[model samples]
Target: MGKAAERFVVEGLVEQTPAGPRLIGSRCRGCGTTYFPQKASCPNPACTDKAPVAALLPDQGTLYSYTVQRYQPPPLFRMDGWEPYLLGLVDMGDGLQVMGMLTGVKEQEVRIGMTLQLVTEPLYCDDDGTAVLTYKFTPAGTAL
Candidate 1:
């Protein structure tokens, strides 16, 4: 059989874990602040700390805010099938708030403060037929 066609949408952002897929981030060693996409150095202007440690964020969070994008995005962003989708920011209960696409829930069905969990799905297939996986948030306990 041919090898499974799979790849991450963005490297070093999400990782497979024993529990499941988890978002990867960096934590500021000086002030205990964490950020997604893994900041190279502390963003805080007041803090002089330059060191950050790799941190894995919780898969679950609350829907803090959201917006629906109905139009096709600009260049470099692939859209195999253009359709409106929910884009939201989730409060990870720490000081970090992560932004990602929302899936598996209708726009009308979404509610503020809704419990959500992280999921990885194919964003698109490349020319070689490798699936590019990206992280998304979904209403907790809603079947895949």
Candidate 2:
């Protein structure tokens, strides 16, 4: 879990799973609304119980939607300069929608239903030279 922890958890920690690593989310045992990395407060109005039990989310999924960011995004990240990046909404089969960049997808090839796996990538930097790693997606395999 060396690299896995480095990517998933900044402290290089991991909550091991038989499937793989994942950021644990909370499930509303009362309303059935699932959240990623879990929510301390329940989004459901019907259930006031903020007791969000931690649950590991599914990692595999098909691309639900996608886009390309061709400009510099905002700060609070380790990114600057102009570059084209792929953005997408991934459906991990459990109704979970996750957003990330395509680390594994090179230019010239991106499509809907492109299978993907989650990966953490360098966001951007300020003047301090600290790298901000954020969760991003990559092509499940060679997209060629």
Candidate 3:
């Protein structure tokens, strides 16, 4: 019934997709401006003439770049202790890009231009003990 309550009800990785399983985003048909997670505003001032339109994010893309955070990102995360992890940005063929955790990795291994997949992670727990979540990209395929 409350914000916190509502968030908890819908918390966790939404394996299911309303519009579709593929990522969804918005592209300003006016100025070609793009937004991730979708938005209701045209970020481009030139395109501000009208409300930002809704669009589905492209599912297929190449790994533009990647890196491993040896240090914990901080309080916003909960994984027992700080674990050096991998993170990466996926360049959806649609010109829109997304950042996500780099799963399917081998210790001390990372490469750019690799394929990726979206995986959700728990952000933190609310006072009511509800766990917040976020999506991250992980490297695809089993590690050698």
lDDT of 2 by residue, 1-144 (tens): 243222321442224465544655678887777787657788777886666787766666788888888766665334545478888988877678877677677656777887887655555543454554566767775422
How does each model score on lDDT? Answer: 0.87, 0.65, 0.60
**Regions more than 4 Å wrong, model 3:** 1-15, 18-21, 107-109, 121-132, 141-144
Q: Which ten residues in a row have the lowest lDDT in candidate 3?
A: 5-14
Residue 92 alpha-carbon offset, candidate 3, angstroms: 1.0
> Count of backbone clashes for each model?
0, 7, 8
Q: What CA RMSD would you report for each candidate?
A: 2.0, 4.4, 5.5
lDDT of 3 by residue, 38-112 (tens): 677776666646455666665445778777788876654565345777767788875777776666675456667
Best by lDDT: 1
lDDT of model 1 at position 142: 74
Measured on C-alpha atoms, candidate 2 has an lDDT of 0.65
Residue 89 accuracy (lDDT) in model 1: 91
For candidate 2, the 10 contiguous residues with the lowest summed lDDT are 5-14
Off by over 4 Å in 1: 1-3
The most accurate candidate by TM-score is 1
Tens digits of per-residue lDDT, candidate 1, 12-124, equal: 99988967789999988988888887888988887777678889999899999999988879967775676889999999977788899999999999999999999987888
| Deviating ranges (above 4 Å) for candidate 2 | 1-20, 80-82, 124-131, 142-144
